[model samples]
Target: MVNENREVTEKIINELLHGKICTDASAFSELHRIATWTNPYVDYAYVDDYSKKTIAIIFFDKYNDNEIIKENTVKAISEFDMVVDAYDVHSLNEANFYLQDITRTRLNALPISVIVYDSNGKVSPLNTISISEHKATKRTVKEQRSYWCWWRDGSHFEVATLLELSQKYDDEQGDIYTNFVYPEFFNLMIEGKTRKWDGTPRVKKYSTSSYKSEKQNYKIPMCQLGLWDVETGHITHKGESVLCVIKRYGADSKEFFDYLAKIILIDGKHLDLIKDLEEFQKNNTELIPESSSEFFILFDDYMTQKNSIGTRKPTAQKTGAKKAYVRDEPKLWNKLGIVKLQGKSRYYKSYVGIEFDWDRINEILLADIFGGSNEKI
Candidate 1:
């Protein structure tokens, strides 16, 4: 499905470049719509510069193949430099990231505002698209980064230097045999190497706890933590507190319960916890009812001092939390594979809900992460 989307996108790009899709306000708008369907994270806007020249504004978020879009945009910019003025490429995550700074228009908006920036530096809006009016029902790109550092040995260590030293040990061994080196000597060696890399003191001043936290928290690229109801076909949350929802609803919904169990097995790696949860369900079925509100109460009760271990936060913390979680949200859970919410019968007002399409989501989840081994041009 990713391949199919890419193929469709490439074809559209070719047509647009070759004048097959006549370059006009309407044409660009049409292209923007098509690109959004292909990948909502990629958006386009028309910018009429001070000289009355029209340029295509391409913006990319963390999601989708930003690198590919960038390469294509660069090529298109060069091709259209003389033909359609100059194309501008911008990163959504970086600062000064918008074409029109006055309105603070987000790049993700569909039919993104068509505005003019004059030589006097005055910004004027030509075509407007309201961010409030259009509500994004599906999971959209929340963040982006090129690389993430991980401990090579897979040992879960919280301290930054400890993890880095561990990472170095595993990395240095790379295909070589492991060793049991003296702790003092190894620490000295690591300190020397660290100082040499940045010409800093052997004992680094700042805390790397934040960096280590980011990597260990299971927040990986392109992960979706959103939870959807299997029967109602509604997304309970979009990349939010899904574990809480699962722990609450797992007993009642087989689909939700199964996925939650798998995640706990894969992420928590605590067979005993799963056993306890199953046991609890069997023994106290009436206490921990199947309803969503009841589920929340049961989960809270399960978190008390007596059951601290079971109540431990799932590796995937709620959105906007300080620390990260165990592993990326099961990519499969992101796709409920059904049409989204048709009504609020099962909607939780406190939490946002998105409609799900099971078949469509399955296609997306099953698609190759690298989009079918295609080489970057």
Candidate 2:
């Protein structure tokens, strides 16, 4: 079916090129309508025998669907041998604006022929095609703050261990995990020296290839948090600063938690828990759930409502949210003393509700850490 459609399209293009108007109303009617349309953009390509290149005729109209325009532009480049783009614009100002666009400016370096199109759909072609050069605009990277690592079982110690190994070994090497990380983990496990932040002995199953793929959970979050330089496998200055704080004041200390909160919130690269917390506080002032399990139910409900409004990414599933917010983030916070866990046991199934330290939370939210200097460290 697709091949037949392509063949028909090719036939239509050939007919149009040869100035033989297609008589098939069902197939060629759209082409004639496009040529006469005052606003809709048209893109057609043909080979130039002299240059042995394919030339793309792009009819630009501001009223056309941007996505369609982009798709047609890309299609012309990909289907052709070597694309020499010719833009049809209404005025000089429109041409200038199109050339200034960061994405569109890339086509400026290609040989371009300008055609003036009036409101009446009359085409006036230029005598000379110009090959010009323009500086490409630098695109800014957008900072995203969602879809965090959902590895609920691992702690900061494991993360620290990975960072330490990355510093000694080049991450670019394929054998870094097999040669370094797994061996070190094996040594730690055998010695019975594996411990959590609070000096608690951590016993877990280990294998040389256990974390080969799982390591991405740590790597992605560490890079997002500005802790590790994944490219170089070295601790960034930000990572170094965090390590210093950990050395001076233990991981369980308030100082360490404060630093974590600052980066997690201010950097805006992980979960937007602060915003969620604020929204929860605003709506449920009288009946705030204290238990982690209870809180999870309410948070899930809140997310359901939020999702209905189409604010979140399509991939942000309820299960993912539960892992990131309910299990992972809360566990970290509880360990660092950012949010105190009450009850006989700190285990998820048995533990009492988490006690929110509003004063500290408020203070952390209002902190001006990056007010003037933008010093992440």
Candidate 3:
């Protein structure tokens, strides 16, 4: 019986390698034969194109007992770039176990990681799932795919297989965007020229203030703030999102700019500016030199007062002066074309501006500095 079982297993393995049992039904038949070994010489069997070059055969029986046959087989197959577990069964009774596992896993599709930047300049991670797919084409052979994100209605969502969701994102032709309307509505879509459809992202804005009022808001991790959506595999921000927040509140008052300062350090896109703030935060003793450039001087005062409240002297007056100076600085940078500052503001002061042109500063921002003209702010 054992000899017969070994012969059957070898034949099945050969057939798998030769692509004879590639379909789900044929693979199951082969696995069943190995599982029904009379002397328990075979444990399980499976076939897949895990090696990339061609189909690979994986099987186990009582003859191999030195290592975990199942675990080793899975690990080996997973190492390949593309693989599909065609069939696996440990015993005759467990013939349908593989199908059941697939069903269960699909019900809870992989958790997606979404990092959102709040108005307060902090980053928070929100896990969202691909809930459904919107058909982008009617053709039978080559259908286009699109996906709908699981709505963030403060409820747990069940996951399921939505292949089109992946295909639509993969087919993105231009820059994608993630826009949050104040507090509730959050949208993600590809930009106009590169977008395949004419769908507007302005969905109904949800009201979460009541919920927020009841719960304390926790700060998001600073590291996850950028535009990358790891779950969907896309680079999405298309406009001046948090920058608008800064422009509105940054220079409004000392209290507001202080908050904006923190936001910039925590979630700012400009790599150099973020580093400067982080350095200043680490070393509070370094005073802003009088001869330093204007931006540095203003930035130093901002950091010194923001981080070293109790330790620094003349807190009130210094803070006040720095606040007054910074309120008009964004306007100056705008007039000099240092940055494409979008909002409206006025600078009534009359003095000779700094001798150098401020264009170099535009290079540092969360957005791509030299992006195509079609790209958004």
Pick by TM-score: which candidate is best? 2
Give the per-residue lDDT of model 2 (tens digit) for 212-276.
54455455566656676545445667777777776677665566556666666444222244345
Candidate 3 lDDT by residue in tens digits, 199-305: 22323223466335212111111112332343332332411333333345442233333232222322232222333333553454344333324544455476444
Which has the higher TM-score value, candidate number 1 or candidate number 3? 1
Ranking by lDDT: 2, 1, 3
Better of 2 and 3 by TM-score: 2
Question: What TM-score would you give candidate 2 relative to the actual structure?
Answer: 0.45
lDDT score, residue 96, model 3? 38
Q: Under the 3 Å rule for N, CA and C atoms, how many clashes does model 2 have?
A: 1
How high is the lDDT of residue 223 in model 3?
13
Per-prediction TM-score, please? 0.22, 0.45, 0.17
Task: Give lDDT: candidate 1, residue 239.
Answer: 15
Q: Global lDDT of each model?
A: 0.30, 0.45, 0.27
Per residue, candidate 1 scores C-alpha lDDT tens digits across 91-131 of: 22322233343235343333233332322323333443323
Name every residue pair that clashes in candidate 2.
Answer: 291-353
Q: Count the backbone clashes (under 3 Å) in each candidate.
A: 12, 1, 3
Off by over 4 Å in 2: 1-151, 170-179, 207-217, 230-233, 244-257, 268-271, 284-294, 307-325, 340-355, 362-377
- Poorest 10 consecutive residues by lDDT, candidate 2: 31-40
